[model samples]
Target chain A: MGQKGSKVQITENDRAILQLKRSRDEIHKFTRRTDLLISSERLKLKEMIKENPTKCKSDPRVRFLLKRIHYQDHLLQQALEQLINLENLVSTLEFKLVETQFIKGLERGNQILKKLNKEFENVDELMDDVQMQIAYQEEVDEVLAHSIVGVNDFETEIDKELDQMEREINPQQQIEMPSVDKLPDLKQRPIASSERKEQGKKEGTEAPVLA
Target chain B: MSNQSELPPIYSFPPLYTRQPNGLIRRQQINSWIEIILQYCISQKCWRMTAEGMPVGEPDVTKQSIFNNSSIQRVVPQVFVDEIWSQMCEEGKALGVQDGKRDSSQFYILWRNLDSWASLILQWFESSGSLNQVITIYELSQGDGTADWEFHGMPEALVAHCLKPLCQRNRATLIKDERGIAVATKVV
Candidate 1:
């Protein structure tokens, strides 16, 4: 008999919860529809009043219109209040439901701890694997360091060769005079005959020896 | 006049109420104002405007003047308004008072010139078989059949002026009673 009574109590609680959910949905829909209607109507009324304030106020219907707006606002406020209360009721009910789930969760706490310990063991194995990979990376780094030092020495040798080449090129550039025959035709035309004769003799003496 | 809602969006612009200082901008502003006035007059069937480009009242609609954008609290100066009127006169879009009056504050806005209005009246007469049928000047201007006509409510003097072109063309006969009142006309 007590079991039957408890079953009835549970069903009553579920029915109350269902009623609350339905009321909440109704309130939500009502609020949405009313909000849209109220805002648009408010805008239109405001514009009408603004367009002709005296006329709007003097009209006998304005009082009734204002009253209707006030009533709508009151309804909206009441609906919002009901909505909040229903939401609170639902949250409290959910928390009460979670309380039982929490107690059930405690029953399996030791098994959860055992699973966590197994996960820690896996983490230790992963750590060891990571250490092995790190040691391999250190060996690779040492080989790379040795190769890099060799490459650095090779680079210095090439730089030294380039320096010697530049030194040889500088003196040869100083000794080398552009040949009159190879000079542009515009430059040759501007030269006097005496200067050309001097240039020819200098070229004949220096050119064959350099060759 | 018809409702003021037919005004262009720029009609509410405050700058249009002030004549631009630059010559080219002023000219363009004048042209825009002229276009607005022409459109407004034509749409409302307004025949006359004050020098300030406001519609002359037959049956008044509103106190709001076209030259003033009251919402913006700006008004085109009367001098500038008169300049626009003179330009309209130059374009033959408006007729000035003829008697060299000092205060010629009123102008007739001619959406169609007096001659065209005259021809239209003549055509109405022809189509309606009222040709050679003498009718009082009042009947011609405000008769039942002419209610839907554009020349309806036209001043008797202006109607006579319009009919002068028709008379010269021998399409109309002006009849004056013994009292020198132009009592009626017969379109031939």
Candidate 2:
């Protein structure tokens, strides 16, 4: 999608022409870069054509040979350009496929996002129910606190009545019971797992296994 | 006895038409022409060689006072000269004939001699019309698109050897191509 250059090979002749145009050094190099599999001593006629052009031209063998050499150089240059173009196109297509794959990954991420949003809504509803339960538990605790205060007053009045009756009944009814001031307040020490295990052992009970 | 006379001292001779590929023979052949052309250039005070006509079919080199080898004055063909130059360039020995349709086929062999060429190269460097700066060896051999002194079809080594005296005077330097052709550079 971006501004990419066409990756086609220009031409062997074109490359050589460009080389000739650009630097004399490269032209000199390219002119000598003959890959033709000509036998060393066998290039006699070809060499003659290149050397004594006037004399070699009349010879039919030399003419055909020169054409073949020129044709070979041309074909090789063409093939090389085509290969380069194909390679460039392949890499460009691969990059496009990678972009499509990335888009698919983004789509999957969006699906995951929707599922997470639904889970969050369910959590919000559960939290609301827990808040209502906490409020109901607070009301029950308030009523229990009021009942305990009333019970404590009733127990104090009964003690006062029992004290008057005992005073009136003389030494024959002297009842002996421990007062509330003698009992220990609720102890809130942290119990370790080890202490719990020891208590279960004293009670002759094994710790239950979790499923 | 008058009729005998040893058949007027008969002699069998070869025309030397086929240029001797021998080291000594080729040198003698080339030297003989160099001697002729050097004298001609000096006599006429010709500064540059022009390979103007059809190099392969040239007939009278000395008559036109040009770079034609097949001159009625000489035995080698203009094509032979081209062949020699092409071989030399292909062999990486500059001064030989070159090949190709361009400036590579016909060569300009200075009748002015190598010494004069050395002097001319130095003079070319001194000239104001040309941007004759000390150029790279590569520039002298295969320049991008400029057709100057190098446009004359000749071997690079020949060019370098012709400029040797200039090189010795520290006025020029021999620049070698990685592929081994000689390029000349002015010391200035």
Candidate 3:
């Protein structure tokens, strides 16, 4: 009957187990009732034999009583067999029900675990995206910090670099004024007029400080 | 017009301010926002909006609160705001500056367009027996006779554009002063 394979572990302390136990108690009650009835009939037959041992078999009333006792014994044996079958059926059904319930719980747990795994993956991807964005923003800030220098400091730095370049290029032609004025417009030109502009700015700064 | 004192219930939902990333959901959100904006404009008699889709009482008024829902403490991002404004303009629900570079941020919310406003003004002129008479733009907008009209407080620039179609059809003549400003129009 594949009985061992059908055995399901019932771990849950719930109503089905309780109901199965209750039915077993009812079956015990039925057995007890049948046992009492059969014993009483046997006792009656014994009494009849004791009272008239020689004629008990030949006596019609005794024979009728004996026949009734035999029928009751047969009925009791059949009831016991039926009760044993019912007990086996009930226990197997109970095992099967528990097995189905356990399987259902396992399947539900597996589905929830899979769903959680998917959600975790989504969260991980989102975190990576946010981290990438933060890294990009920091890089942009670094570039901006490098490019956006204070105007006064930037001008003075340019002035110093231009003075060095001018000294290296030509020492005597420094007095050329018109070309110096136009030097600001050309991209690749060595700084020339910025020296004068820097002097003007220095004067402006000192005036403001003095005022 | 519906009363302007109360805003729609969804105005308080914080998610509405966030640009939804999902395609179908974002389209639905945009449609609802457009409806709410139009309804709010109609209620408040607002005609101008900024690049950020904020309703303004006058073109000069800055920092409107339609895009900023203080109750929920959420501000629609400027990029999304600009998108909504451009969409409205594309749908002919608003008019923008002809020159793309100059103040494209400003828009005229055409809840009722220039054409409809022009027709309403012409109807008023017909009923009031003011046809064939030159009325200044100021008189058409704020004159005592126009006090109860829907276009009473409309801008003269919009009025002139609306009158252009009429002038083209010889239904009206636009007169400008030495400053080249359209001063008045005479409807025939």
Candidate 4:
């Protein structure tokens, strides 16, 4: 009783549970109606007495209504107690249903786990194969490494050549070299611009000797 | 009735009793009436009112009824009362009780709308941990369980009205009796 493709299965137990709940609801509705009737009847009786105290007190219908109200009150109380019990039963049944489903789910899970475990029974052997392959790879790596002599030397030579080429391509390297030696001299002298230019001309002529 | 003294000062004003001629002033006047009606109902805890501007349960026209300002010797005319009710209905602050009737004799004074009332009921259910529990409508409104609640003592019809939104949204289910009266509801 669901969508076109998805039909919900309603078993006898489900129908029983539904019947129980429906009875419980009926009991609840009965108690509520009884409560309303009792109160309203009481109010009517009170109003009747107020309107005509002597005649109402003597009225047989009033007595009958009072008796009926009392009987309904008793019935209401019994129904309420029954409702409580029914509700408890329904909740317990629902909880048991949930627990049953849960246990069934766990059983399914257990079966799947057992099947998976069976499939993985040779896990240790597989691990041994992997370990053997890893060892073989390590041995091959070591043999290759031993056969690769002069590779480090060639790499170092290439690095040295790269450094030299980088220095040759970068004009900032030449400027930085002289600046390191000239910084102390300039800091010590603090030469003015004009005197610094004259000193620079003299230094340019004496640059070869200093080098 | 005892809270009559707590009514606003405008209740005693004579002009409020008369429908103003000017459209803007008349609109404002109707608005003032709406506010007064809402405030007076809240203060008196009155839920339903007749078109004549008298609370439903009170049998006779009492001096304390909002329509009649006894001290001022003025009563709101029927036309003005109808106007106010229409405005209140438009604003979702009141509901006509009779089906297929434009000017129903009685209407619910919804100082709070049904949606808000639905939320309030839901909040109460959550706070009381009554979710998935069956509770009689009578108990929800008048039983000791809801003795201290704001909606306590609310009429059963109003309670049912408030639950409509919840029922539509699948938040609750209303169980009816053989007579097709909703006697209980289960909120989930």
Number of the top DockQ candidate: 4
For model 2 chain B, the run of ten residues with the poorest summed lDDT: B4-13
What is residue A104's positional error in candidate 1, in angstroms? Answer: 99
- Residue A165 in candidate 1, Cα distance off native in Å: 99
Provide the DockQ value for model 1.
0.00
| Isolated chain B TM-score per model | 0.83, 0.39, 0.82, 0.91
Model 1, C-alpha of A172: deviation from truth (Å):
99
- The TM-scores of all predictions, comma-separated, are 0.43, 0.27, 0.42, 0.55
TM-score of chain A of 3: 0.43
The CA lDDT of each predicted structure is: 0.73, 0.50, 0.70, 0.80
* DockQ, every prediction: 0.00, 0.02, 0.00, 0.03
lDDT of model 3 at residue B181? 73
Query: Which of candidates 3 and 4 is the stronger one according to lDDT?
Result: 4
Off by over 4 Å in 2: A1-71, A119-126, A159-211, B1-188
Greater TM-score among 3 and 4 belongs to: 4
lDDT of 2 by residue, B1-188 (tens): 11212211211112333467787877665544444433443344332343432222123323442333332233446665554444433433223234322245344445544667666656655663222233434444444323465323334555676667765655555544466665435444
Candidate 4 C-alpha error for residue A128, in Å:
7.5
Model 1 CA lDDT for position B68:
76
- By lDDT, the better pick of 1 and 2 is 1
Top candidate when judged by lDDT against the true structure:
4
Report the C-alpha displacement of residue B111, candidate 1, in angstroms: 1.0
Per-residue lDDT of model 1, residues B87-188, tens digit only: 777776777655323247777777787678888988889877766445456567755568888888776656776787777766766666477646567666
